[model samples]
Target: MHVGILYSRIRRDEKLLLNELRDRGHEVEKIDVRKQQFGLDRMTTDVSELDLVIDRCLATSRSLYATEFLDSYGVTVINNPRTADICADKAKNSLALAEAGVPTPNTKVAFTTDAALEAIEEFGYPCVLKPVVGSWGRLMAKIDSRNAAEAILEHKATLGHYEHKVFYVQEFVDKPGRDIRVLATDGEPVAAMTRSSEHWLTNAAKGGKTAAFELDETALDLVETASDAVGDGLLGIDLMEVGGAGSGEYTVHEVNHTVEFKALNDSTDVDVPARVVDWLETKAAESDAAEAPIA
Candidate 1:
Protein backbone atom coordinates (compact mmCIF):
# COMPACT_ATOMS: atom_id res chain seq x y z
CA MET A 1 0.00 0.00 0.00
CA HIS A 2 1.13 3.55 -0.66
CA VAL A 3 1.21 5.78 2.42
CA GLY A 4 1.92 9.49 2.64
CA ILE A 5 3.27 10.96 5.85
CA LEU A 6 2.34 14.65 6.12
CA TYR A 7 4.80 16.45 8.35
CA SER A 8 6.78 19.67 8.71
CA ARG A 9 9.73 18.05 10.48
CA ILE A 10 10.84 14.46 10.99
CA ARG A 11 10.85 14.10 14.75
CA ARG A 12 11.91 10.88 16.51
CA ASP A 13 8.28 9.73 16.58
CA GLU A 14 7.92 10.22 12.83
CA LYS A 15 11.24 8.48 12.26
CA LEU A 16 10.05 5.40 14.10
CA LEU A 17 6.92 5.23 11.95
CA LEU A 18 8.89 5.78 8.75
CA ASN A 19 11.37 3.06 9.63
CA GLU A 20 8.57 0.64 10.48
CA LEU A 21 6.65 1.31 7.28
CA ARG A 22 9.82 0.89 5.17
CA ASP A 23 10.74 -2.34 6.96
CA ARG A 24 7.35 -3.73 6.03
CA GLY A 25 8.04 -2.88 2.35
CA HIS A 26 5.20 -0.40 2.12
CA GLU A 27 5.66 2.46 -0.31
CA VAL A 28 5.96 5.61 1.82
CA GLU A 29 5.85 9.23 0.68
CA LYS A 30 7.01 11.98 3.00
CA ILE A 31 5.11 15.17 2.20
CA ASP A 32 6.57 18.19 3.94
CA VAL A 33 3.78 20.69 4.63
CA ARG A 34 6.20 23.63 4.85
CA LYS A 35 7.14 23.30 1.18
CA GLN A 36 3.72 22.38 -0.21
CA GLN A 37 1.01 24.71 -1.45
CA PHE A 38 -2.67 23.72 -1.27
CA GLY A 39 -4.90 25.14 -3.97
CA LEU A 40 -8.69 25.27 -3.65
CA ASP A 41 -9.22 22.24 -5.91
CA ARG A 42 -5.82 20.60 -5.66
CA MET A 43 -2.39 20.68 -3.97
CA THR A 44 1.15 21.16 -5.22
CA THR A 45 1.93 17.66 -3.89
CA ASP A 46 0.15 14.88 -5.78
CA VAL A 47 -1.49 12.47 -3.34
CA SER A 48 -3.72 10.69 -5.84
CA GLU A 49 -1.66 7.49 -5.79
CA LEU A 50 -1.46 7.30 -2.00
CA ASP A 51 -3.69 4.76 -0.29
CA LEU A 52 -3.60 6.69 2.98
CA VAL A 53 -2.17 9.94 4.35
CA ILE A 54 -1.20 10.19 7.99
CA ASP A 55 -1.49 13.67 9.51
CA ARG A 56 1.73 14.07 11.47
CA CYS A 57 2.35 17.81 11.28
CA LEU A 58 3.69 19.12 14.61
CA ALA A 59 1.89 22.42 14.40
CA THR A 60 -1.87 22.19 15.10
CA SER A 61 -2.68 24.99 12.63
CA ARG A 62 -0.72 23.29 9.87
CA SER A 63 -2.23 19.91 10.68
CA LEU A 64 -5.78 21.23 10.59
CA TYR A 65 -5.41 23.19 7.36
CA ALA A 66 -3.32 20.60 5.54
CA THR A 67 -5.64 17.72 6.45
CA GLU A 68 -8.69 19.77 5.53
CA PHE A 69 -7.18 20.55 2.15
CA LEU A 70 -6.16 16.95 1.54
CA ASP A 71 -9.64 15.81 2.53
CA SER A 72 -11.19 18.30 0.11
CA TYR A 73 -8.98 16.89 -2.67
CA GLY A 74 -10.64 13.46 -2.17
CA VAL A 75 -7.58 11.93 -0.53
CA THR A 76 -8.04 9.72 2.51
CA VAL A 77 -6.43 11.32 5.56
CA ILE A 78 -6.33 9.61 8.95
CA ASN A 79 -8.07 11.45 11.76
CA ASN A 80 -10.12 13.23 9.08
CA PRO A 81 -10.53 17.00 9.16
CA ARG A 82 -13.61 16.85 11.36
CA THR A 83 -11.70 14.93 14.02
CA ALA A 84 -8.76 17.29 13.65
CA ASP A 85 -11.02 20.30 14.03
CA ILE A 86 -12.46 19.01 17.31
CA CYS A 87 -9.19 17.78 18.81
CA ALA A 88 -7.09 20.82 17.82
CA ASP A 89 -8.91 23.19 20.17
CA LYS A 90 -9.20 22.74 23.94
CA ALA A 91 -12.73 24.17 24.07
CA LYS A 92 -13.95 21.80 21.37
CA ASN A 93 -12.15 18.86 22.94
CA SER A 94 -13.80 19.44 26.30
CA LEU A 95 -17.23 19.96 24.82
CA ALA A 96 -17.01 16.78 22.75
CA LEU A 97 -16.02 14.73 25.80
CA ALA A 98 -18.75 16.24 27.99
CA GLU A 99 -21.37 15.93 25.28
CA ALA A 100 -20.53 12.24 24.95
CA GLY A 101 -20.89 11.77 28.74
CA VAL A 102 -17.23 11.02 29.24
CA PRO A 103 -16.03 12.04 32.69
CA THR A 104 -13.68 14.95 32.01
CA PRO A 105 -12.29 17.71 34.19
CA ASN A 106 -14.87 20.41 34.86
CA THR A 107 -13.71 23.04 32.37
CA LYS A 108 -14.76 26.63 31.73
CA VAL A 109 -13.84 28.90 28.86
CA ALA A 110 -13.98 32.68 28.78
CA PHE A 111 -13.15 35.14 26.05
CA THR A 112 -12.07 38.11 28.21
CA THR A 113 -9.81 38.54 31.21
CA ASP A 114 -12.64 39.62 33.51
CA ALA A 115 -14.81 36.65 32.62
CA ALA A 116 -11.76 34.40 32.81
CA LEU A 117 -10.99 35.71 36.25
CA GLU A 118 -14.50 34.84 37.27
CA ALA A 119 -14.02 31.29 35.93
CA ILE A 120 -10.74 30.93 37.84
CA GLU A 121 -12.44 32.13 41.00
CA GLU A 122 -15.27 29.66 40.43
CA PHE A 123 -12.88 26.76 40.04
CA GLY A 124 -10.92 28.19 43.01
CA TYR A 125 -7.20 28.13 43.71
CA PRO A 126 -4.91 25.33 42.54
CA CYS A 127 -6.91 25.02 39.33
CA VAL A 128 -5.31 24.89 35.93
CA LEU A 129 -5.02 27.56 33.21
CA LYS A 130 -4.11 26.20 29.77
CA PRO A 131 -3.69 27.61 26.31
CA VAL A 132 -6.60 26.80 24.02
CA VAL A 133 -4.32 25.04 21.53
CA GLY A 134 -1.08 23.45 22.77
CA SER A 135 0.55 20.20 23.80
CA TRP A 136 3.46 18.81 25.90
CA GLY A 137 2.24 20.86 28.87
CA ARG A 138 3.45 24.19 27.43
CA LEU A 139 1.72 27.44 28.51
CA MET A 140 -0.18 25.67 31.30
CA ALA A 141 -0.35 27.17 34.78
CA LYS A 142 -1.40 25.68 38.08
CA ILE A 143 -2.91 28.76 39.64
CA ASP A 144 -2.39 28.39 43.38
CA SER A 145 -3.70 31.75 44.45
CA ARG A 146 -5.99 34.62 43.42
CA ASN A 147 -2.97 36.88 42.84
CA ALA A 148 -1.42 34.34 40.50
CA ALA A 149 -4.67 34.06 38.57
CA GLU A 150 -4.89 37.83 38.20
CA ALA A 151 -1.30 38.07 37.02
CA ILE A 152 -1.59 35.20 34.54
CA LEU A 153 -4.84 36.52 33.17
CA GLU A 154 -3.27 39.94 32.82
CA HIS A 155 -0.36 38.48 30.88
CA LYS A 156 -2.65 36.50 28.62
CA ALA A 157 -4.90 39.51 28.06
CA THR A 158 -1.93 41.53 26.86
CA LEU A 159 -0.88 38.87 24.36
CA GLY A 160 -1.89 39.75 20.81
CA HIS A 161 -3.22 36.34 19.79
CA TYR A 162 -6.93 35.61 20.18
CA GLU A 163 -6.17 32.14 21.60
CA HIS A 164 -4.45 33.66 24.61
CA LYS A 165 -7.59 35.70 25.27
CA VAL A 166 -9.64 32.49 25.20
CA PHE A 167 -8.82 31.25 28.69
CA TYR A 168 -9.28 27.50 29.38
CA VAL A 169 -9.64 26.81 33.06
CA GLN A 170 -10.19 23.39 34.62
CA GLU A 171 -10.62 22.04 38.11
CA PHE A 172 -7.33 20.48 39.08
CA VAL A 173 -7.38 16.73 39.60
CA ASP A 174 -5.13 15.66 42.46
CA LYS A 175 -3.89 12.70 40.48
CA PRO A 176 -1.39 10.97 42.75
CA GLY A 177 1.60 12.57 41.10
CA ARG A 178 0.93 10.71 37.86
CA ASP A 179 -1.42 10.44 34.89
CA ILE A 180 -2.10 7.83 32.26
CA ARG A 181 -1.47 8.15 28.51
CA VAL A 182 -3.12 5.45 26.46
CA LEU A 183 -2.32 5.16 22.76
CA ALA A 184 -5.39 3.87 21.00
CA THR A 185 -6.18 3.11 17.36
CA ASP A 186 -9.84 3.53 16.49
CA GLY A 187 -10.81 3.18 20.16
CA GLU A 188 -8.59 0.15 20.68
CA PRO A 189 -5.63 0.25 23.06
CA VAL A 190 -2.18 -0.09 21.57
CA ALA A 191 -0.43 0.29 24.93
CA ALA A 192 -0.67 2.29 28.12
CA MET A 193 1.88 4.15 30.28
CA THR A 194 1.96 6.27 33.39
CA ARG A 195 3.76 9.61 33.47
CA SER A 196 4.86 10.44 36.99
CA SER A 197 6.51 13.62 38.23
CA GLU A 198 6.62 15.67 41.41
CA HIS A 199 5.39 18.71 39.48
CA TRP A 200 1.73 19.24 38.63
CA LEU A 201 2.44 18.84 34.91
CA THR A 202 3.58 15.26 34.36
CA ASN A 203 3.93 15.24 30.59
CA ALA A 204 6.76 13.09 29.28
CA ALA A 205 8.00 16.21 27.47
CA LYS A 206 8.09 17.88 30.89
CA GLY A 207 10.62 15.34 32.30
CA GLY A 208 8.04 12.95 33.70
CA LYS A 209 9.17 9.43 34.55
CA THR A 210 7.39 6.69 32.60
CA ALA A 211 6.33 3.11 33.32
CA ALA A 212 4.10 0.54 31.68
CA PHE A 213 0.60 0.59 33.15
CA GLU A 214 -2.01 -2.15 33.19
CA LEU A 215 -5.40 -0.66 32.37
CA ASP A 216 -8.36 -1.83 34.38
CA GLU A 217 -11.80 -2.33 32.85
CA THR A 218 -12.89 1.18 33.79
CA ALA A 219 -9.85 2.76 32.18
CA LEU A 220 -10.31 0.63 29.08
CA ASP A 221 -13.89 1.81 28.83
CA LEU A 222 -13.02 5.48 29.22
CA VAL A 223 -10.29 5.19 26.62
CA GLU A 224 -12.78 3.83 24.07
CA THR A 225 -15.47 6.39 24.93
CA ALA A 226 -13.06 9.32 24.84
CA SER A 227 -11.67 8.16 21.51
CA ASP A 228 -15.17 7.95 20.01
CA ALA A 229 -16.12 11.31 21.51
CA VAL A 230 -13.42 13.08 19.51
CA GLY A 231 -13.79 10.91 16.34
CA ASP A 232 -11.42 8.01 16.69
CA GLY A 233 -8.19 7.61 14.84
CA LEU A 234 -4.69 7.18 16.19
CA LEU A 235 -5.15 9.03 19.48
CA GLY A 236 -3.54 9.72 22.84
CA ILE A 237 -6.22 9.63 25.53
CA ASP A 238 -5.09 11.25 28.81
CA LEU A 239 -6.82 10.22 32.01
CA MET A 240 -6.31 11.32 35.60
CA GLU A 241 -7.25 9.12 38.55
CA VAL A 242 -10.02 10.66 40.56
CA GLY A 243 -8.91 8.86 43.72
CA GLY A 244 -5.55 7.07 43.44
CA ALA A 245 -3.66 4.90 41.03
CA GLY A 246 -5.51 1.71 41.96
CA SER A 247 -8.80 3.55 42.15
CA GLY A 248 -11.10 2.56 39.32
CA GLU A 249 -12.46 6.08 38.86
CA TYR A 250 -10.96 8.20 36.09
CA THR A 251 -11.59 11.44 34.21
CA VAL A 252 -10.23 11.83 30.68
CA HIS A 253 -8.54 15.20 30.34
CA GLU A 254 -7.79 15.27 26.63
CA VAL A 255 -7.69 13.37 23.34
CA ASN A 256 -4.76 14.18 21.06
CA HIS A 257 -5.15 13.78 17.28
CA THR A 258 -1.54 14.01 16.18
CA VAL A 259 -0.26 11.89 19.09
CA GLU A 260 3.46 11.19 19.55
CA PHE A 261 4.43 7.76 20.86
CA LYS A 262 8.23 7.47 21.03
CA ALA A 263 7.99 7.92 24.77
CA LEU A 264 5.28 5.28 24.98
CA ASN A 265 7.33 2.87 22.89
CA ASP A 266 10.28 3.30 25.27
CA SER A 267 8.16 2.87 28.38
CA THR A 268 6.42 -0.35 27.31
CA ASP A 269 7.58 -3.71 26.00
CA VAL A 270 5.04 -3.41 23.20
CA ASP A 271 6.34 -2.80 19.65
CA VAL A 272 4.43 0.48 19.43
CA PRO A 273 5.30 1.45 15.89
CA ALA A 274 4.58 -2.04 14.59
CA ARG A 275 1.10 -2.03 16.13
CA VAL A 276 0.42 1.43 14.69
CA VAL A 277 1.49 0.22 11.26
CA ASP A 278 -0.80 -2.76 11.55
CA TRP A 279 -3.70 -0.41 12.15
CA LEU A 280 -2.63 1.76 9.25
CA GLU A 281 -2.67 -1.22 6.91
CA THR A 282 -6.15 -2.14 8.05
CA LYS A 283 -7.45 1.39 7.50
CA ALA A 284 -5.88 1.60 4.06
CA ALA A 285 -7.42 -1.72 3.00
CA GLU A 286 -10.80 -0.54 4.26
CA SER A 287 -10.52 2.62 2.22
CA ASP A 288 -9.62 0.65 -0.88
CA ALA A 289 -12.49 -1.73 -0.41
CA ALA A 290 -14.89 1.16 -0.02
CA GLU A 291 -13.71 2.73 -3.26
CA ALA A 292 -13.67 -0.47 -5.32
CA PRO A 293 -15.86 -0.43 -8.43
CA ILE A 294 -19.18 -2.28 -8.12
CA ALA A 295 -19.57 -5.55 -9.96
Candidate 2:
Protein backbone atom coordinates (compact mmCIF):
# COMPACT_ATOMS: atom_id res chain seq x y z
CA MET A 1 0.00 0.00 0.00
CA HIS A 2 1.16 3.52 -0.79
CA VAL A 3 0.90 5.98 2.11
CA GLY A 4 1.33 9.74 1.96
CA ILE A 5 2.65 11.47 5.11
CA LEU A 6 1.43 15.05 5.33
CA TYR A 7 3.88 17.19 7.27
CA SER A 8 5.45 20.65 7.29
CA ARG A 9 8.54 19.36 9.07
CA ILE A 10 9.47 15.75 9.75
CA ARG A 11 9.99 15.65 13.50
CA ARG A 12 11.28 12.61 15.42
CA ASP A 13 7.72 11.28 15.65
CA GLU A 14 7.27 11.44 11.88
CA LYS A 15 10.69 9.86 11.38
CA LEU A 16 9.65 6.84 13.49
CA LEU A 17 6.49 6.30 11.41
CA LEU A 18 8.44 6.71 8.17
CA ASN A 19 11.09 4.18 9.19
CA GLU A 20 8.49 1.67 10.32
CA LEU A 21 6.49 2.01 7.11
CA ARG A 22 9.63 1.62 5.00
CA ASP A 23 10.81 -1.38 7.04
CA ARG A 24 7.43 -2.99 6.48
CA GLY A 25 7.97 -2.50 2.69
CA HIS A 26 5.07 -0.13 2.34
CA GLU A 27 5.47 2.61 -0.30
CA VAL A 28 5.75 5.95 1.48
CA GLU A 29 5.17 9.38 -0.10
CA LYS A 30 6.44 12.38 1.83
CA ILE A 31 4.08 15.23 1.08
CA ASP A 32 5.43 18.54 2.41
CA VAL A 33 2.36 20.47 3.51
CA ARG A 34 4.19 23.81 3.34
CA LYS A 35 4.85 23.39 -0.37
CA GLN A 36 1.52 21.86 -1.38
CA GLN A 37 -1.41 23.78 -2.77
CA PHE A 38 -4.77 22.21 -1.95
CA GLY A 39 -7.56 23.41 -4.18
CA LEU A 40 -11.25 23.11 -3.46
CA ASP A 41 -11.56 20.48 -6.16
CA ARG A 42 -7.95 19.23 -6.38
CA MET A 43 -4.47 19.39 -4.96
CA THR A 44 -1.44 20.46 -6.98
CA THR A 45 0.29 17.21 -6.04
CA ASP A 46 -1.38 14.04 -7.27
CA VAL A 47 -2.64 11.70 -4.52
CA SER A 48 -4.75 9.49 -6.81
CA GLU A 49 -2.40 6.49 -6.54
CA LEU A 50 -2.07 6.60 -2.77
CA ASP A 51 -4.04 4.07 -0.75
CA LEU A 52 -4.13 6.31 2.30
CA VAL A 53 -2.94 9.77 3.38
CA ILE A 54 -1.88 10.02 7.03
CA ASP A 55 -2.08 13.55 8.36
CA ARG A 56 1.01 14.41 10.37
CA CYS A 57 0.85 18.15 9.90
CA LEU A 58 2.17 19.87 13.06
CA ALA A 59 0.05 22.95 12.65
CA THR A 60 -3.62 22.49 13.53
CA SER A 61 -4.71 24.86 10.75
CA ARG A 62 -2.77 22.87 8.17
CA SER A 63 -4.03 19.52 9.48
CA LEU A 64 -7.65 20.71 9.47
CA TYR A 65 -7.62 22.18 5.95
CA ALA A 66 -5.37 19.54 4.41
CA THR A 67 -7.59 16.65 5.46
CA GLU A 68 -10.73 18.51 4.40
CA PHE A 69 -9.40 19.09 0.90
CA LEU A 70 -8.08 15.54 0.63
CA ASP A 71 -11.48 14.16 1.62
CA SER A 72 -13.11 16.29 -1.09
CA TYR A 73 -10.93 14.52 -3.68
CA GLY A 74 -12.05 11.03 -2.59
CA VAL A 75 -8.68 10.34 -0.96
CA THR A 76 -8.81 8.57 2.42
CA VAL A 77 -7.20 10.53 5.26
CA ILE A 78 -6.86 9.13 8.75
CA ASN A 79 -8.46 11.12 11.57
CA ASN A 80 -11.02 12.64 9.20
CA PRO A 81 -11.44 16.39 8.86
CA ARG A 82 -14.49 16.55 11.13
CA THR A 83 -12.50 14.86 13.89
CA ALA A 84 -9.67 17.27 13.24
CA ASP A 85 -12.04 20.21 13.41
CA ILE A 86 -13.34 19.15 16.86
CA CYS A 87 -9.98 18.17 18.33
CA ALA A 88 -8.10 21.24 17.09
CA ASP A 89 -9.97 23.70 19.31
CA LYS A 90 -9.89 23.59 23.10
CA ALA A 91 -13.49 24.85 23.38
CA LYS A 92 -14.73 22.11 21.07
CA ASN A 93 -12.59 19.48 22.76
CA SER A 94 -13.96 20.37 26.18
CA LEU A 95 -17.55 20.37 24.94
CA ALA A 96 -17.28 16.96 23.28
CA LEU A 97 -15.78 15.30 26.32
CA ALA A 98 -18.34 16.85 28.69
CA GLU A 99 -21.31 16.14 26.44
CA ALA A 100 -20.34 12.50 26.20
CA GLY A 101 -20.64 12.23 30.03
CA VAL A 102 -16.91 11.82 30.33
CA PRO A 103 -15.35 13.06 33.57
CA THR A 104 -13.54 16.15 32.30
CA PRO A 105 -12.39 19.05 34.42
CA ASN A 106 -15.06 21.70 34.97
CA THR A 107 -14.61 24.17 32.11
CA LYS A 108 -16.09 27.52 31.14
CA VAL A 109 -15.74 29.58 27.99
CA ALA A 110 -16.07 33.32 27.56
CA PHE A 111 -15.58 35.62 24.61
CA THR A 112 -14.60 38.82 26.42
CA THR A 113 -12.23 39.69 29.24
CA ASP A 114 -15.02 40.79 31.57
CA ALA A 115 -16.97 37.58 31.07
CA ALA A 116 -13.76 35.57 31.32
CA LEU A 117 -12.86 37.27 34.59
CA GLU A 118 -16.29 36.41 35.87
CA ALA A 119 -15.72 32.77 35.03
CA ILE A 120 -12.38 32.80 36.79
CA GLU A 121 -13.96 34.38 39.85
CA GLU A 122 -16.74 31.83 39.83
CA PHE A 123 -14.36 28.93 39.53
CA GLY A 124 -12.22 30.67 42.16
CA TYR A 125 -8.45 30.87 42.28
CA PRO A 126 -5.97 28.23 41.14
CA CYS A 127 -7.96 27.60 37.96
CA VAL A 128 -6.38 27.31 34.54
CA LEU A 129 -6.47 29.74 31.65
CA LYS A 130 -5.67 28.22 28.27
CA PRO A 131 -5.71 29.37 24.69
CA VAL A 132 -8.66 28.13 22.65
CA VAL A 133 -6.21 26.51 20.19
CA GLY A 134 -2.76 25.25 21.21
CA SER A 135 -0.79 22.24 22.32
CA TRP A 136 2.48 21.20 24.03
CA GLY A 137 1.67 23.36 27.07
CA ARG A 138 2.01 26.67 25.21
CA LEU A 139 0.10 29.79 26.38
CA MET A 140 -1.43 28.10 29.45
CA ALA A 141 -1.50 29.77 32.84
CA LYS A 142 -2.53 28.64 36.30
CA ILE A 143 -4.28 31.63 37.78
CA ASP A 144 -3.67 31.75 41.52
CA SER A 145 -5.33 34.98 42.61
CA ARG A 146 -7.85 37.56 41.52
CA ASN A 147 -5.06 40.00 40.69
CA ALA A 148 -3.26 37.40 38.62
CA ALA A 149 -6.46 36.51 36.83
CA GLU A 150 -7.12 40.18 36.08
CA ALA A 151 -3.62 40.70 34.71
CA ILE A 152 -3.79 37.59 32.53
CA LEU A 153 -7.20 38.60 31.29
CA GLU A 154 -5.86 42.07 30.44
CA HIS A 155 -2.97 40.58 28.54
CA LYS A 156 -5.22 38.20 26.63
CA ALA A 157 -7.68 40.99 25.83
CA THR A 158 -4.89 43.05 24.29
CA LEU A 159 -3.77 40.23 22.02
CA GLY A 160 -4.87 40.81 18.43
CA HIS A 161 -5.96 37.30 17.56
CA TYR A 162 -9.59 36.33 18.02
CA GLU A 163 -8.54 33.01 19.53
CA HIS A 164 -6.93 34.79 22.46
CA LYS A 165 -10.14 36.65 23.10
CA VAL A 166 -12.00 33.37 23.53
CA PHE A 167 -10.87 32.39 27.00
CA TYR A 168 -11.00 28.72 28.06
CA VAL A 169 -10.92 28.33 31.80
CA GLN A 170 -10.95 25.07 33.75
CA GLU A 171 -10.63 24.03 37.36
CA PHE A 172 -7.12 22.82 38.02
CA VAL A 173 -6.88 19.16 38.90
CA ASP A 174 -4.62 18.53 41.87
CA LYS A 175 -2.93 15.62 40.25
CA PRO A 176 0.08 14.02 41.87
CA GLY A 177 3.13 14.61 39.74
CA ARG A 178 2.18 12.95 36.48
CA ASP A 179 -0.54 12.54 33.87
CA ILE A 180 -1.25 9.63 31.54
CA ARG A 181 -1.08 9.79 27.75
CA VAL A 182 -2.73 6.90 25.97
CA LEU A 183 -2.12 6.28 22.28
CA ALA A 184 -5.23 4.57 20.99
CA THR A 185 -6.64 3.60 17.59
CA ASP A 186 -10.43 3.97 17.39
CA GLY A 187 -10.49 3.77 21.20
CA GLU A 188 -8.33 0.64 21.43
CA PRO A 189 -5.30 1.25 23.59
CA VAL A 190 -2.05 0.60 21.77
CA ALA A 191 0.19 1.92 24.56
CA ALA A 192 0.10 4.23 27.55
CA MET A 193 2.70 6.43 29.30
CA THR A 194 2.93 8.74 32.28
CA ARG A 195 4.49 12.18 31.97
CA SER A 196 5.87 13.58 35.20
CA SER A 197 6.88 17.18 35.73
CA GLU A 198 7.39 19.77 38.47
CA HIS A 199 5.39 22.33 36.52
CA TRP A 200 1.61 22.39 36.24
CA LEU A 201 1.92 21.58 32.57
CA THR A 202 3.23 18.03 32.30
CA ASN A 203 3.44 17.68 28.54
CA ALA A 204 6.39 15.65 27.27
CA ALA A 205 7.22 18.59 25.03
CA LYS A 206 7.38 20.72 28.21
CA GLY A 207 10.32 18.59 29.46
CA GLY A 208 8.34 15.98 31.39
CA LYS A 209 9.82 12.54 32.05
CA THR A 210 7.90 9.61 30.57
CA ALA A 211 7.33 6.02 31.73
CA ALA A 212 5.00 3.21 30.77
CA PHE A 213 1.54 3.06 32.37
CA GLU A 214 -1.05 0.29 32.57
CA LEU A 215 -4.62 1.40 32.03
CA ASP A 216 -7.47 0.26 34.31
CA GLU A 217 -10.99 -0.63 33.20
CA THR A 218 -12.30 2.87 34.02
CA ALA A 219 -9.58 4.46 31.92
CA LEU A 220 -10.34 2.10 29.08
CA ASP A 221 -14.00 3.11 29.28
CA LEU A 222 -13.17 6.82 29.21
CA VAL A 223 -10.84 6.32 26.25
CA GLU A 224 -13.59 4.65 24.26
CA THR A 225 -16.23 7.23 25.18
CA ALA A 226 -13.91 10.17 24.49
CA SER A 227 -12.85 8.72 21.14
CA ASP A 228 -16.45 8.29 20.03
CA ALA A 229 -17.29 11.79 21.28
CA VAL A 230 -14.58 13.32 19.12
CA GLY A 231 -15.32 10.82 16.33
CA ASP A 232 -12.88 7.99 15.56
CA GLY A 233 -9.24 7.93 14.44
CA LEU A 234 -5.72 7.63 15.79
CA LEU A 235 -5.72 9.71 18.98
CA GLY A 236 -3.78 10.63 22.09
CA ILE A 237 -6.11 10.83 25.08
CA ASP A 238 -4.88 12.74 28.15
CA LEU A 239 -6.12 11.88 31.65
CA MET A 240 -5.29 13.35 35.03
CA GLU A 241 -5.63 11.32 38.19
CA VAL A 242 -8.22 12.72 40.55
CA GLY A 243 -9.26 12.24 44.24
CA GLY A 244 -6.61 10.86 46.62
CA ALA A 245 -3.40 9.14 45.56
CA GLY A 246 -3.95 5.93 43.60
CA SER A 247 -7.64 6.74 43.57
CA GLY A 248 -8.16 4.90 40.27
CA GLU A 249 -10.27 7.73 38.94
CA TYR A 250 -9.48 9.90 35.89
CA THR A 251 -10.63 13.06 34.19
CA VAL A 252 -9.94 13.21 30.47
CA HIS A 253 -8.66 16.61 29.39
CA GLU A 254 -8.10 16.38 25.66
CA VAL A 255 -8.05 14.17 22.55
CA ASN A 256 -5.23 14.99 20.18
CA HIS A 257 -5.31 14.41 16.43
CA THR A 258 -1.96 13.91 14.67
CA VAL A 259 -0.59 12.71 18.04
CA GLU A 260 3.17 12.28 18.48
CA PHE A 261 4.53 8.98 19.76
CA LYS A 262 8.35 9.05 19.85
CA ALA A 263 8.30 9.72 23.59
CA LEU A 264 5.83 6.90 24.09
CA ASN A 265 7.90 4.51 21.96
CA ASP A 266 11.08 5.24 23.91
CA SER A 267 9.38 4.77 27.28
CA THR A 268 7.37 1.63 26.60
CA ASP A 269 8.13 -1.85 25.26
CA VAL A 270 5.35 -1.57 22.71
CA ASP A 271 6.31 -1.12 19.05
CA VAL A 272 4.48 2.19 18.57
CA PRO A 273 4.99 2.73 14.86
CA ALA A 274 4.39 -0.88 13.93
CA ARG A 275 1.05 -0.90 15.69
CA VAL A 276 0.15 2.37 13.98
CA VAL A 277 0.96 0.76 10.63
CA ASP A 278 -1.19 -2.18 11.59
CA TRP A 279 -4.10 0.18 12.14
CA LEU A 280 -3.27 1.92 8.89
CA GLU A 281 -3.35 -1.40 7.06
CA THR A 282 -6.79 -2.13 8.46
CA LYS A 283 -8.03 1.33 7.44
CA ALA A 284 -6.60 1.00 3.96
CA ALA A 285 -8.19 -2.42 3.48
CA GLU A 286 -11.47 -1.06 4.78
CA SER A 287 -11.26 1.79 2.31
CA ASP A 288 -10.50 -0.62 -0.51
CA ALA A 289 -13.39 -2.92 0.39
CA ALA A 290 -15.74 0.04 0.60
CA GLU A 291 -14.71 1.32 -2.81
CA ALA A 292 -14.90 -2.10 -4.49
CA PRO A 293 -17.96 -2.46 -6.73
CA ILE A 294 -20.75 -4.75 -5.55
CA ALA A 295 -20.84 -7.86 -7.75
In model 1, the clashing pairs are none
Q: Estimate each model's TM-score.
A: 0.99, 0.99
Once superposed on the true structure, which residue ranges of model 2 sit more than 4 Å away at CA? none
| lDDT value, candidate 1, whole model | 0.94
Find the 10 residues in a row with the least total lDDT in model 2.
239-248
Alpha-carbon error at 205 in model 2, in Å? 0.6
Worst 10 residues of 1 by lDDT: 239-248
